[model samples]
Target chain A: MSWLLALPFFIPITTALIAFLARGRKHLCSVISITGCFAALCVSIAIVTLVVSGGPQAAQMGDWQAPYGITLIADRLSAVMLLISAIVGLCVALFAISDINENRVKLGFHCFFQLLLAGVSGSFVTGDLFNLYVWFEVMLIASFALLVLGGEKIQLDGGIKYVALNLVSTLLMLTSIGLLYGLTGTLNMAQLHISLAEVDNPVAISTLAVIFICAFGIKAAIFPLFFWLPASYHVPPVAVTAVFAGLLTKVGVYALIRTFTLIFPNDLGFTQNILLGAALLTMLTGVLGAAAQYEFRKILSFHIISQIGFLILGLALNSPLALAGTVFYMIHNIVAKTNLFLISGTAQRLAGSYELNEIGGLYKASPLLSTFFFIAAFSLAGFPPLSGFWAKLLLVKASLDQTAYFVTAVALITGALTLFSMSKIWAEAFWKPHPQGHCKSLYSLSVAERLQRLLPVSLLASITLILGFMPEPFIEYALGTAGELLHPDDYLEAVLTGSSH
Target chain B: MNSIILQTATRVLVALILVFSVYMLLRGHNYPGGGFIAGLIAASAFALFAMAWGMEAAQSALRIPPGNLAVSGVALAGLSGLMAIFYGDGPFSGQWLTLIGAKEEDGIVISNVLFFDIGVYLTVLGAVLTLIFALEEAS
Candidate 1:
């Protein structure tokens, strides 16, 4: 049973090895990757169940214990995150098999895709801060490769900026690990949790906290630090871009929550204020950035920045309820965001362009796509009855409870802006007529192309709806996970106690 | 492809990076550096040699693409974390051994974490070098 915890990271990696050695068989490589995704998903779920039934599991490499040995811990928070990452990774992998062209496949797309998943899953499950940084690099390296899969002028240009910025983040994070180790004596997350609380110089601790925030914040694509994402995310194949939209930056957000909640809980006073204000600005900037865009994928990329603010508000509030909302929002955002990207790709397939000016009257072209698009759009905009609604409801209620009037107002306003931005996409890309000139140039798809295109995305779309309707189980788990985070004594005990045991 | 002296130096430096990377990983637990810094240090060594020699010559000489080095490094590093599952330590627990004898009596038997560090070392060295090589070749 304990062997299952290793599967999520191991399966893809092994399959990746096999895929790489398949001697240029592109079809076999893709099939191997998709199979790895499903296996990882099942293992992720089993690990969560194991954590729930048998209690938290800690493993020390080579029989060497912690403080002396590097450790991996699968606590409630990490197991739940592993599950979420597996879902997103699996859905995107399946979607990519169909949406990715054969030309792109020859570009080592499967290799990059598998590496990205490995990096992401490693980040979710690792217990050491240093290991997490390596995982970050893993993901970033793969992302850079994927973003420029075709090596086009725009991709290379945009990928350069993305790579440089991320490299800086990695350098900063590595330095912070040095700082934390120099200051406190451990890179183990639980040990750091215990050690950081004992450090007396309030100022030094606060400075370290800010450094961590900057390091992770860049990855999350928060405001004032998010320009690189929209610049580069739009350059990749639609499937690759869509998955990055769903997963990459969210890892940053996850790091923020993990660090703030676990490593620096005692020093949240000034940092939380800064993060709170940044959240509002991020929300506005993202939606506004979306509004200013005429390209379909670019608009969604901008919105990613804005929606992250909602997730951050939960962490900034620093309460159980707010944390739960943050968790819920992260889940809802992944599903809805992936859905939008996939559907938008479908729109591109049928309509022939991502430029809104060139793509109009989606309602006239295909009713089914518009319906699915509407579901994802409304859910993203925080409309009631969907999962997005409940997440926002939790966040809003938490804000009001804390009497954070500024954020409360900002949340409602952001909701409006979100709705407005999504509608612009629907109207311009779906409702409005593709002016006579553009319509004449539309690309027609073969019947098989259409079916191959719709099946995987539709499966994901249905998952989004089902989760939205039955969010109770998920919500309860989120509340529990958030609770464990706020009260991380259990996590501390899991690591520290295991070392002594 | 030009001169024997320069080619010899590149080979020496690449070997040096590999050794230096290991030293850093083992020294990390108690000192200023650890697996990550050591890994990068080693990688940088390879990168410097790659810069000195052409990327193609380096890739072929290594007998495999550096990209695979990066990929395998990540997998090995992750497997290092999963090492704890076999023991009862939970997920990513630290496994350190303090070996006694020879010149350094208090020397620790480097655990698989060093292997993890080497993994990172290769990945960093390979990934950045591959990228730089690709960009350079493209131009």
Candidate 2:
């Protein structure tokens, strides 16, 4: 059973080694990468089924007891997270086969790609806080390598800012973890939950909670700490940016949700209010920043920050429904956002540039590409009958149920602003005539090349459509995860008593 | 590329460092000297070798690219954990076996835990050397 949890990360780490070893053999590397991702996907599905049917599962490394040895736990949240990550990972790996050129692969792009997947999978399943930190570093290091893989001057500049800010946040997280350990005398999250309750000093715990907020806040790219995101995210290739945009900040958001719900539930008054204020600001500022951008990818990058605000809003509400809404929104946004980036990549290939002013006529050149852009872009903007609409509706309803009128208004306004920026992209990149009156067409590409590029884009877009049309099961799952999170007794018992199944 | 004295010292130092690194790796299970430090020591020996001789000598000495070495290290370290799974234990659970003919009074033991340590030793050494060699050769 524990092996099921380990396989998600283990498959990727091992595949990375094999892929790197077979560096010059593109066919071999692709085979290894694809097979690894497929295995991880299968394992994730199995683990999710077990969690949904049985309950949370845990396994101590080296057979060590709880609160002593490193542990891996797969509760509802972790299982769902792993399932989504594997899905995106496999898709991106397939996409990269055609999207990434020969020179980049020779620079170990496939290796780092798998390593990043390993890190994300590890982050989801880890049962200890320090182990979580280790996973963050794993993800961070791989991301840094991926970000600057091309060694272009602009990428290096972006990479420096990305690393510098994240390093500061990492140090801050470490400091808080150290303090939390001193306070509770344990690094295991379940143990910390119990130990934190036993502590008498609310002031000290509150201070430590603030440190955690600052740390994860920066990583999550909430307002005032989001400068690094827009600066760095657009510099990487579309495939790299797609994965980072989809997973990286979400890890920060995941940590925030996990910590606030499990460890610091005692002082919602102090933390929730702070989060509410930040959430509103993040939404407004992120959308406004997007409105100011002309590059297709740049606009999408700012949207990542704004969408994070909606997710954070659900966390601040801290109600069961609100948390469930956040979970649903997270799933919806990841697929939709990643598809948008992937579509932008194909569009860029046809349009001959990412700059909106220099490129146009895509709608006439390739209506197929235009349709993909429409579905993804509008879905991101919360258009009705699409995935984003449902995600936004849940959040709006959650806010209304709590009578947080201010938050409700902010969310709606942000959605409107998002639509505006997305429409701006549509008008510039797709709807309008080319500034030069001519643009390359996707139809010009070979059949195999076209399929390789559009396969992942269509796959992800279909998922968004499925999540929209058939949202009942996903909603039920999210609510169940919310219930488990709000009441963590099952997770605690699973780890403390060893896995029951 | 290097002074005669420096080249002479590198040869002896490299051999001594490699031997000491093995000692540290073996003792790491119960002591402070572990795979990480031992790997660093081994990498430093090669780094010193690279400095004394040219990049070509270091390349010939390694006999494989540092990138490939790091890849193998990661694979070895990860596979070591699978030993427990075959033994019907949890992932990464330690599996031990006593030598078949050894007497109890011999005071020596062997385990899969040591395999994991060796994997770590290789990973750190390979990864560090990869980074240093890339920068050195590029410059």
lDDT (CA) per prediction: 0.80, 0.90
A339-367: candidate 1 lDDT, tens digit per residue:
89988888887777999888887787678
Candidate with maximal TM-score: 2
Error of 1 at A85 (Å): 1.7
Which candidate number maximizes DockQ?
2
List TM-scores for all candidates, in order. 0.85, 0.98
The residue pairs that clash in candidate 2, if any, are none
| DockQ agreement of candidate 1 with the native complex | 0.20
Off by over 4 Å in 1: A437-448, A499-501, B1-139
Cα misplacement distance, residue A16 of candidate 2 (Å): 0.5
Writing each residue's lDDT as its tens digit, candidate 2 over A329-448 gives: 999998888888888888888888999999999999999888888888898899988888988888899999999998999999999999999999999999899998888888799888
